[model samples]
Target: MTLFAVDIGGTKIAAGRVTEQGDLDGPVLTTTTPATQGPEAVLDAVAALVRQLDDRGVTAAGVSSAGVIDSSTGTVLGSTTSISGWAGTPLSHHLSQAIGCPVFALGDGHAFALGEAVYGAARSATSLLVLAVGTGVGGSYVRDRKTLTGSHWAGGHFGHLAVPQAEGLLCDCGKVGHLEAIGSGPGMLRWYYRHGGDPRLLDARELFTTADADVTAAHAIDMGAAAVGTAAGGLVNAFDPDVVVIAGGLSQAGPRWEQPLRASFTRTLIPALSGTPLIISETDAWLVLRGAAFYAQTRKDIA
Candidate 1:
């Protein structure tokens, strides 16, 4: 059996075909996501891709979107303002009608957890927490091999957890002192700039590179790691997950960030759970896409 998967993000849309064993078939298709265009345009792009696959004998589709999704009805409840006309849209129904196939929709974070639990870092674990921290922080909690979607489908919103920081750090959600305001890549850069660091180091990569040779940049990296570690410690204590998998672009900084991150986590976690293993995924970019494919393969009936 074959399953079609789509991963929709703020900047790109990725589609792939996969088998039951989580192996992708054929080349993955990529296209720039039109943040300025409305939902119609986004749907049109997805439909166009599906049509291309349909000509090649593909049918069912699953979508992993970077927004609050009502999985029960396949609706995108809310999305970043940058992606115009995405709020409260019935994405599943629209896509189903547009592409002439059954559609299953899941949040990107939740899809990532599903992917990891089925085939990646946490495959042997029954309970796990997965964090994908890049432009923003997205989290998912999986218990007994099932994704946890709490009341209003907000169970794994770890990024919204308030952080202990000064009042001026702004979050994408318009809040101050949230985890994303301090630990996310953009947030770290913002904090660096606020602390008199050069604004030329506009992203996490540049900041980490500078930190490798500059004292001030190293200080910024340490601060970011500390904040992330504190947050991870809290998550371990709260969920007592068997495994914590970090997967995202920022995680690629290697030891420059991991040492401090582990140190801070060890300092904050209770002794009992401190020993829980934390693994960083090697294939960060495709984890979400693979997870979406896994979800589709398992739910073929829905597809």
Candidate 2:
């Protein structure tokens, strides 16, 4: 049966067809998310996008969304300010009703982890931990193709973990000393500016590119990467996953960020966990899409 995949983020809404082999078929369709227009508007926008991609052959659609999602109920339990009025949204039910197809929804972190475990960098591993460094840090732990979602569906929110590097900085969640405050792309840029880096360097992408020549930018990048590595090391000690995968936008920042990150991760691990492999994701949006399709296929009862 033909399946559909959707990934909903604060900045974009993307949809595509998923082949039976759990691969994305053809090009992905995209549009801006109406994040500030409230939950209903956002749901409607997603439904519209799905309609554009729907062929009569579609039996279900799987969604990978940003939030603390309860996949069973397809509901958003909590969300960040990036998407206004996104919390408590009945995503699966709403989208299913709108498109006349079964809809399965899960947190983007969980979906991303599952994607990597099944088809991406960690495909060979029996268990793995994934840290996605982008606008913010997202993470998940997966074993045997299933994610370890916490009781409140908040598992793998590694960005919220407290880290020494973030100690005086304020996190977006109103918490102090959280990983995201120091490891995220924005966090690195903020660090650069706070440390008297050139003001002309705007955004994390620019800051990363400028790191080649500017000492301040390089320091900021290294510090952020180190913070991420430190957190990963601690998590590896706890979960003892066979592999740790790094995904998301910052993973593409090149060796400047990765070398320090590896150094910190290796330094933090205990003797037993010292040999864990750290893999970087090579696929992009298709990874999430493939995971979403897998979710929909496995949860056919909901249909």
Tens-digit per-residue lDDT, 36-118, candidate 1: 88888888887777666633545567799878888888898877655787878798899888877678888888888788777
Tell me the RMSD of model 2 versus the true structure.
Answer: 1.2
TM-score, each model?
Answer: 0.94, 0.97
Kindly provide the TM-score of model 2 when superposed on the true structure, using C-alpha atoms. 0.97
- lDDT for predicted candidate 2 compared with the true structure: 0.89
Per residue, candidate 2 scores C-alpha lDDT tens digits across 19-41 of 77887776789989999999998
TM-score of candidate 1 on Cα atoms, chains taken together: 0.94
Best of the candidates, TM-score = 2
